[model samples]
Target: MATSSNFFIHTFLISSLTFFPLSPSLADDDTDKPVVEQLVDTLSTIAGPHPGIRKNHAKGIVVLGEFTPSAEASSVSSAEHLQSASTPVTIRFSNTTGIPDIADTNPSSFPKGIAIRFQLADNSYTDIVSISVNRFPVATPEDFLGLLNAVAASGPDTPAPKPITQFLASHPAAKTFVEIEKPAPVSFATQPFYGVNAFKFINKEGEVNYGRYQIIPVNGPEYLTDEQRAAAGNNYLFEELPKRLKQNKAEFILALQLAEKGDEVNDPTMVWPETRQLVKLGTLTIESIDPNGEQFAKQTMFNPLALTDGIEASKDPILLARPSAYAISYGRRLSGQ
Candidate 1:
């Protein structure tokens, strides 16, 4: 029997063939375009061009922290970075979409992002990047571009059966991703974050496991009520985080959701079943706001692919394409474009 998800994908493919058929030459032309450039172009269409700013998740705050691996973490990895020791960290929390001044209460800012750079014991560094949502809208880079294109086509003068509606009618996962209501969080520290991409983790005994990373907030998950959302300031998250840090340290547990033998390791769109086991890897504690927040935000480039010996990225096309897309954004920022 076909799963609902499988049926959806099959139906979507058939609908796409009928409504948006492409010639062989057109398909080849699309394949020839760089993923990074396509990503930037898609973002520009959605949010308008903002030179020198990130293509998405532009509004953010930078902070300083430390990561202390759990006692059990060392058993899983001989990597010096995983040893139970205090490692300095640079952390940034941001809202989704490319609008730099978007209000925190806006629905477009539903899936917030967290990026952390850990300065390892060996004087090297690694980065972990995650978002509040666990599942992605599309499986592949091409599908993601198509979703963006659909959004771009639905302008003020768009006729009935909007491009996004047509796209959603075919793509069930993307439809679900858009339809899901992600309420506003009370503060960045109160929301749980998930590393949507799968990664291979190697243990000291050379045992390798595929899993996605999760960051569970020590403060517990909290959200703003509709009334609270209406009353909040445009930069509530930005204001709340620093004020909360001053009152008490913010913390989160780092965990891994291990995949079963048959899990889809390369498709971020397919979330692993909840029955999978979870291993607590470490704790991340944000002690204070960075005094030089502006400078730190400007200088830091948080790449998800920056990994140590124990961890390696999976073959997910979206995961593989991130570094290059990030580099394009980073270069524009550095050149003051």
Candidate 2:
């Protein structure tokens, strides 16, 4: 039951190695120690050491919901959640950066995040981690680390052509990402989220297709104007969410945009043509906020590679590194770092 057809008329939208396995349940290995440590260190430097919170996307609120698959979904993937039965889901919407108290109005928070955990039978689950930006700033974990290092080094007296400026100058993709217009949304419920990385969707017939996720608000996007944004409170987005949920449930269309032949399925920095095919997967209906959401979020870790059967990670370097990087953050959060 998709609405906002006119809005659809307007827009459209990684695998692993043993050392860098594509599984989220991976334990800490010696090989990944340095990379994980470096990422956590750099993020801490950028955000100034926030403990007991995520190293990134620390400012988030969790909610409980459900996902009902479309009939066409089973044709695209044999994933259990894509079957006839509806599944429960845990959703977290957050602003970017590790600053837990950062104001929702801050520019750095523009590219918001939405992480979804679909719970299946037998204590298993899968997750979809996406951001508001259509494409990522970098393709590999190394480049992302470089970007973070540059930001951490650039200060008021860092001079013209600062470290971040130099990084962006040599990295055109990152420059494009930074230059993207990020207007404030009226609420997270009104914003669309894009999965920058690609994954392989395989059906029971063994047919395969590489695609990314596009989660659209069924009510369409509505943003605050300049004057309204200027007058908004620091916690405007956070406060608006529960009240909006109180009035009625928020709904989103969960779809996948299939990649055509010759498309770069490995590099997140690359954007697929909007003309790519969009497949209906399901509808995610968020009925209410979980009373224990805050406490639960602190303990729950949402991993993109936490895949179920019928879904596989593509060979995207950034995608391969996400679980390890997130694990370090989760570890620290558990230890109250």
Candidate 3:
């Protein structure tokens, strides 16, 4: 007999199929209803609605730190936030999915989240939101919603080649994303996060460079073995970070993978070639976990579009859709819904 956890996982996989059938109709509606509303509605259906809760990555811890710019960084962008001696930073680490209490060891929890906020000299702040996975499943917001809707459409009673199968068949990138193995990290500090969307970096000379952000752990990446995974607890990732931080600071190198002329900046689903140059922008040293980390994580909203001068969002539709989707999520949480 399957355990409760196994049952939940099985049900979730089937329920996800319900989403695909709804996608085409929603995509064609062209209604004045904000895309964020539709996105949230779709997410709520898949994750199950929970008032005062985030639609995804619901469990997380926030840490306070300072970002020290690299001497070499001065050549990349003239953004004042990056030029400052030291900018205060807030970083949040979280598991995947909106199921708040999902087991950390679950396969559904593979692609974790890392959201950062840099407090600038003028008291303004900018955010960089990333995930453990380098590539996104879909290129546009419409397709992402469609993908979710496809998953939601699947049920235990649905046919073997369900809507999700058909959806993945048409969306090759989505199929690849689903098929990829995203192993659980031993700890949040051991994961390498990637900002899937591309951004424009403007230098002092007004020259522009397009690149994606990459956050690599200074201690290097680490993952659990099968034996280790079998022995870990449900809340191991959340529990391990605080203890680890007490022993030593966690650090990550902030770098950018520059895009060549032919690279597609508009599609986040298409990852850039690995041959691109990587420029070090700064180092993030997380000295300690915030005592009120959980509360802070619950209340704060990290917006990728909340950018400062010299850095701007790309033309990616999915990227453009993020701020509004985040706003909707923030408002719902604040209203205690």
Q: Model-by-model lDDT, in order?
A: 0.76, 0.79, 0.77
* lDDT (10s digit) by residue, model 2, range 266-308: 9998999989999999999999998999898899888999999
- Estimate, for each residue in 1-337, the C-alpha lDDT of model 3 and write its tens digit: 1244234433333222211112224345645666667665655555676778887677778898889988867677888767749788999998766678878887766578899999888888899999888887777766766666666555556666766778878999877776676677889999999988899999888889999999999988999998999899999998999899899999999999999998999898789889999998999999998988878877888999999889988998878877887778778888876
Question: What global local distance difference test value does model 2 have?
Answer: 0.79
Indicate the residue-level lDDT of 58 in model 1: 79
Question: Which candidate order results from sorting by TM-score in descending order?
Answer: 3, 2, 1
Which is the leading candidate under lDDT? 2
| Candidate that beats the other on lDDT, 1 or 3, i.e. the better one | 3
Off by over 4 Å in 2: 1-33, 151-163
Better of 2 and 3 by TM-score: 3
Best by TM-score: 3
Model 1 steric clash total = 0
Tens-digit lDDT track of model 1 for 10-29: 32322221111112122235
Specify the poorest-scoring 10-residue window by lDDT in model 3.
Answer: 15-24
Residue pairs in collision within model 1: none
Error of 1 at 204 (Å): 0.7
